[model samples]
Target chain A: MNKYDKCVQYILNNQNHFYRIAYCYVKNEHDAQDVVQNTIIKALENINSLRSIGAIRTWFYRILVNESVNFINRNMKEIPYEQQSIFDTEYTTGFYQPDDELMQLVLSLPNDMRTIIILHVYEQLTLKECAAIARIPQSTAKTRYYAALRQLRTGMEDCNERK
Target chain B: MNENKDINFDKSRDAYNNMAIPSTLDDKVKEAINMSAGKKHTNNRIIITVASAAAAIVVLFIVSVNTSTAFAATLSDIPVIGNIVKVVTGRSFSEKNDNVTINVDIPQINVDSTSAPDTAHVTAEQVNAVIQKTVDDYMQEQQSVIDDYKKSFLETGGTIDEWNQRTIDLAARYEVKYQDDRYLSLYLYMYMSAFAFTQDNYYYNYDFVTGRELTLKDILGDDYINIANQSIIEQITEQVNSDSNAMYWGYHPAGYSGTDPFEDTDKFTTITDDTSFYLNADGNPVICFPKYSIAPGYMGVREFVIKRS
Candidate 1:
C-alpha cells in the first residue's frame, strides 16, 4: 500500500535466518534483535539511499556491525577481567551451532584476527565482499583471512594434542 | 575425521535458518517508523549518528551472563577506585583490580554555609535532616528510582541516617554566615535545588558550596508554593506547560507545571519576613520575608534583585 508497508512485509518474511546469523556474532539474542531493529530502521529511514538489491544484506549488516561495536564500546566500561567465564555460563543453551571448541579458539585470537574469521568463514561473505563490508582493502582482507585460518588451525591442533 | 560431523558451513546455515528472529518486533518497528516518518524523511531529527546506534554485526559475548554479580562484587570490594576507574577509562575495573585500597570514608559532599554552624551541641545530621526529609518526601513520587537507589545504598553497607550525616558533614566544611535571620549555606542549597528561583517541587538541589544535597521543600513550604504557582501563571498568563503539550485555559487539571518558585512574595509573610540574611549581600529579604512568619529549616532570600547592582 505504501513504501513502509511494502518494506515491512519484506522484512517480516525474510527476518528469521538473518536474526540467527546476527546471533552468531553478538551472542546474545536481545542484542542481536536490538542490532536488527536499528538495522531495518536505518534501511527505512534511508530507503532512497539504496540503489540496488544486491547491496541490501551487506549494507544492512554494515549498520549492524557498527551498532554492535558501539554497544560493546558503551558496555566495555562495565566489564571486568574476572568474569571471563561469563560467556561460558551463558553458553549452556543449545542454540549455538558453531563448532564450540573451534569458535572458542577463534575468539581467543586477537580482535583483528577474529574479525577476519567471522567475516570470511562464518558469514560466508567472499573476499571482495568481506573487504567491502570490513571497509578494508581487498589485499588486506585476503591477508588477514589467511592468517586467521592458520591461527584457528594451529589452535585446534593444540587442543587435539592436549586431549 | 568424519567430514559430515565436522559442523561445516552448510549445517551452520541450516541452524541459522531454524532460529527465528522475534516476530513481536513488528509493532515496535512500525511505531518507530510511523513516528519518524516526517522527521527522518527530511533529516530534521537527530538520526542515529553515533555508530553506537548502528550494528557492528560481530556480537562479542563479553557482556558475560554474570554481569549483575560482577556489578555487585564491585560495590563491596572497591569503592572510590571502582567508580573512578569506570569513570575515567571507558572500561569496567576488573575484579582483579579489586585489590585497590578502599577507604571506608563517609561519602561527604562539601557544603559552604555562610559560616561554621554556631550551635556547638548540634550534630551534622540535625542540620541535614531538614534537606533529607524533603528528599525522602520527593522520592515518594520517584518510587522506582528511589527503590533502586535505596537498595544500592543498603547494599553498599550504607544506612539511611548516613546520607543525612554526610550531607551535614559536607555543609559543615563550608562557612555558614548568618546575615539577617537565615543561614546562608542552607538558603543557597534550597535555591540551587529549586532550580535557581524558577523551578521548584523536586528535591534536585546540588549544593554548589560543597556538592552536598538539599531538597526543595526544605527551603520552600506551603505559602511559597502557592505564590510560585501564581507567579508562573502571570508569566505564561493563561497558557501552561502541560505534561504532553502546552495548552490554554481549561486544558489540564493541575494548573502550571506545579509551581513557579520566583513568584513575588509581597503578599506572603512565611519566609522572607523573618529569616535573617547570612551569606552575601545584606538587607531585608523579599522572597522568604517576615522575620517571625518563617519556619525553621525553610529559608530563602526576599526580593533582592532590585537592590543589587
Candidate 2:
C-alpha cells in the first residue's frame, strides 16, 4: 500500500483518541462526528507539516477546537441556553454525565474562557501546553482557568439558591 | 473519579478509550479529504489559467450591464454618459447607439468573438451555427443585389452562373462588404462570419453602419501581405467618417489596393483621396493626417490614422 493509505490505517487505529478530544469540545454525537471529519480534512491539507504521526493527536485536537469554534460561530445567534437540549442529551448516553449546572456555567463564559476550562478540566493538558495550543502566555492561561472556575462556582451557588 | 491530589491519568485515558467515536468517522474523513483536495486542485488551476490568459491580452471589454440608475453624487445636471451607464460593457463600445460611457473590462475578449456574424456567445461548436445563420442572412440580403449584379454582368453576352460562383465563393471571408446606397447615405460595416479576419468596411453615410466583407482573392489580392490589412484599413476609415451628425452624408471607399483607386492613397480626391499614412509601430512617425480641406459638413469623419503602412 502507498504511504497515504498506510496513514489512513494509522488514523483508524487512533480514532478513539481523536474522538475523546472532539467530544470534549462539541459535546454532541453528530457535531463530534462533523468535527472529526473536518479534522481529517485539515490533517491531509497540512500532512507535510505534520512533524510526526505521534503528534497527530495534538495536531488533530487543535484543528478540532478551531473548527468547532468556527462551526459554533456560524450556528450561534443568541445565547438562549434553552436551545442546548441536543448537547445535554448527547452526553447523557455517554459513560460519564457532567454537572449540568456546571456545564451551563462554563458554556456561558466567553469563548476564550470556555476554551481554557475545557482544555484544563477535560483535556488535562499542562498549563504550558495549553498556552502553546492557545498561543497565549502561561500566566494568561492560568488567569482564564481561575476566572472560569470562579464563574462556575458562582453559577453553582446561584442554582443552589434557586433550588 | 479522583480522590487523591493527582487524579489517575491512566484511568482517565482508559475512560476516554471507552468513549465511542461517531459512526463512519473514518469514511467521512476520507470523503472530506478527497473533496478538499479536489477543490484545492481546481482553484489552483483556475488561478493559473486566468493569470496566463491575462498576459498582454487585448480583451474586448464587456462592460457592466447594471446601467440602471443607482446612488452616487455627480456635479452635473447635464446627465452625462456615466449616469446612463452604471457599468460599461467590458467589451465593445458604441458612441451613438450606446449612450452609456461605461468603463468596460472583458476577460474573454477576442477579435473572433467580436467578428461573430450573430450576437451570441460564439464558441467553437457554435461556429457552424453562426456560419449557417450568416449564410442565411447573406442570401436574404444579397439575393436581389446578386441578381442585379448578375443581370448586368450577363447582359453583355455572358453566363450568370460564373458571376454567381464569385458571390458563392464569398464564404472564404465570412463577411460581405458593399457601398450599397439604395437610399441616400448611411453605410454599414457588417462582419458576417464564423471564420477568420475578414475585411470590415465603412458606409459612413448611413445610420445602419457596417463593415464590408472581402473575398480571399480581395484580401490576398495580387499583393499577399496586404489582403488582411486592406479590410482593417476600411474599418478605420469608416469609423473616422462615421458620426451622428454626418450619419448619412459621410464618405467611405468601396474597395482597396491599386485595383480600387479610392483605397490606394491617403488623399481623398476622387482620383487620389488617400487619407492614410505609414508609420513604424514603436511610436515612430507613420501615417499622420495632413490638415487637408474637406467639405464643411463632412469634417466629422476625416480621421488621422497612424499605422505601419
Candidate 3:
C-alpha cells in the first residue's frame, strides 16, 4: 500500500489513542471527538509532509497535541478545580476508574507541567518524544515530570491524612 | 514510590488510556478524507492566487480588526495562517484618585497556523499572564513612589489637602511595530516626563516548522556575538561621522571629544544571549539598544541593522 493508505489505516486502527489524547485537554466526549476529527482531517491534508514512516507516530502525536491545545485555548475558559469534574464515569468503566483526587490535582497544574505528566505518565511516551512534542528541552521535560510526580505525591499524602 | 501510590497513578493513567472512541468516528474520518481529496486541490489554487495579494490585504484587515473590542480574545483563536496578529486590548485597571494617575495599554499576541504550529497552540492565558504581570509590577512600583511622596510631603509641613492636589501622570503603551510570518516586534513605551520616558523593544522569532523560539546564535552561528558586535560598531561609527546631526555617546576627534565606547573591539561583550532583536521585512536583524545606552537620550533608542553576508 502507498503511504497515504498506510496513514489512513493507522489512524483508523488507533482511534482510541487520538480520542484519549484529545479528551485529556477538552475533558468532554463530544469536544474531544470534534478535536480528533479535525486532527484527522488536518493530518490527511498534510500527509505529504510526513517525511519518514518511522517518524510518523511522533509527527502524528505532534499534530494531535497541537489540535487539542488549539481547541482548549479557543473554547474553554479557566474553570476552577471545584467546578471541574475529574471523571466522566458514564463513558468509562472497569479498571479505568479515575482517581478523582489525584486527577483533580493533575488538572490543577499549569498547562506545561500538566502536558508533561500526561505525555510521560499517561501517554507512556519516552522523555525525548515528550520534549520534542512539547517543543521544550529534554532536561526541562525531565525536571517537570519529576516536579509533577512530587506534587502528586504531596497531594496524595494530604488526601490520605484527611481521610 | 509505594505500591498504593503507584496504583492510584496507574488508575488515573488507565482512565484516559481506555478513552471510548465513538463508533461513528471512523466513518466520519473516512468522510472527511474523501471530502478533503477535492478541497485540498481547491485550497492549493486559492493559496497560489492569494499569495500575491496577501501583503496589501493582510495589513488592511489587521488594522481594522485591531480596533474591535473583542480583538484580543479572538486573535488568539485564529489558527493556521502563519501570521502574527497583535491587538492592544485590556480593561483599564488604571486608577486616578488623588496622588497619581496610571494609564496602561496591554497587548496580546495572536498566532495563526502558518506562523508555526507550536505558537498557534499558545493559549490566551499564557500570553495574557506575561502582560498582566508586567503591568502589575509597574503599578506596584508607582504605588510605592506615590506613598513615598505622600510621606515626604507631610514631613515637610505640607497639608493632606495640598498633597492631594499634587499629581503625577504616568502612562504605558504597547505597540506592535512589525510582524510577518517569521518575526514579531513589540515596543513598550513608558512615559513620565520628557527625561523619564523609556522605550523597550521585544523581538520574537520562531522556527517556521517547530515553532520553537530562535536566538541569535541559532541564526548567526557560534561567533554570532562577535559578528553582531562588529556590525553594530561599524554601523554606529558610520552614523556618527557620516550623518550631519547624528551623534553617538562615543569619541570622534573631528567632532565631539569623549572616550570612544567602540574603541575596544570587545564593544559588544555586554550583549547577553537574551539581548532583544527583531528581523525587518528583508530578514535583517536589527539590534535594539535602549535609550541613553549607546547614545544620548536625544537620539532616542538606537537600532543597528546588520546586513549578513
Q: Point to the candidate with the largest TM-score.
A: 3
Question: Per-prediction DockQ, in order?
Answer: 0.08, 0.12, 0.16
Q: Candidate 2 local accuracy as lDDT?
A: 0.42
Best by lDDT: 3
Q: How would you encode candidate 2's per-residue C-alpha lDDT over A39-138 as one tens digit per residue?
A: 7767666664555556655565677678877776655555455446644564345644434545545555677887776666656778777777777899
**Model 1 ranges with Cα > 4 A deviation:** A1-10, A51-54, A80-83, A88-119, B1-8, B20-309
Q: Model 2: per-residue lDDT, tens digit, B1-309? A: 222223223444444445666556644554454444444444334433432232112121111111111111111222322222111122332231121111212112122333333222232123233333333354344334445656676898767455433312222121121222211121222321211112122221111111111223321235423533454456446653553122111233232111211222333432122222222223221222211123111122233322333
| Model 2, position B301: C-alpha lDDT score | 25
Q: Cα RMSD (Å) per model?
A: 25.0, 29.2, 27.3
Tens digits of per-residue lDDT for model 1, B163-196: 3332110110122222222122223221111100
Best by DockQ: 3
Give the lowest summed-lDDT range of ten residues in model 1 chain B.
B190-199
Shift of residue B144 alpha carbon in model 2, Å: 68
Which stretches in model 2 have alpha-carbon errors above 4 Å? Answer: A1-10, A52-54, A77-108, B1-20, B33-309
Model 2 reproduced share of reference interface contacts = 0.33
Report lDDT (CA) for all predictions.
0.40, 0.42, 0.60
**What is the per-residue lDDT of model 1 for residues A1-163, given as tens digits with 9 covering 90 to 100?**
2233345455655565446545655666677677666776777666544445457666666665666666655555566663356555644355443456666565556555665666666667787887777788999987886777677667767889999
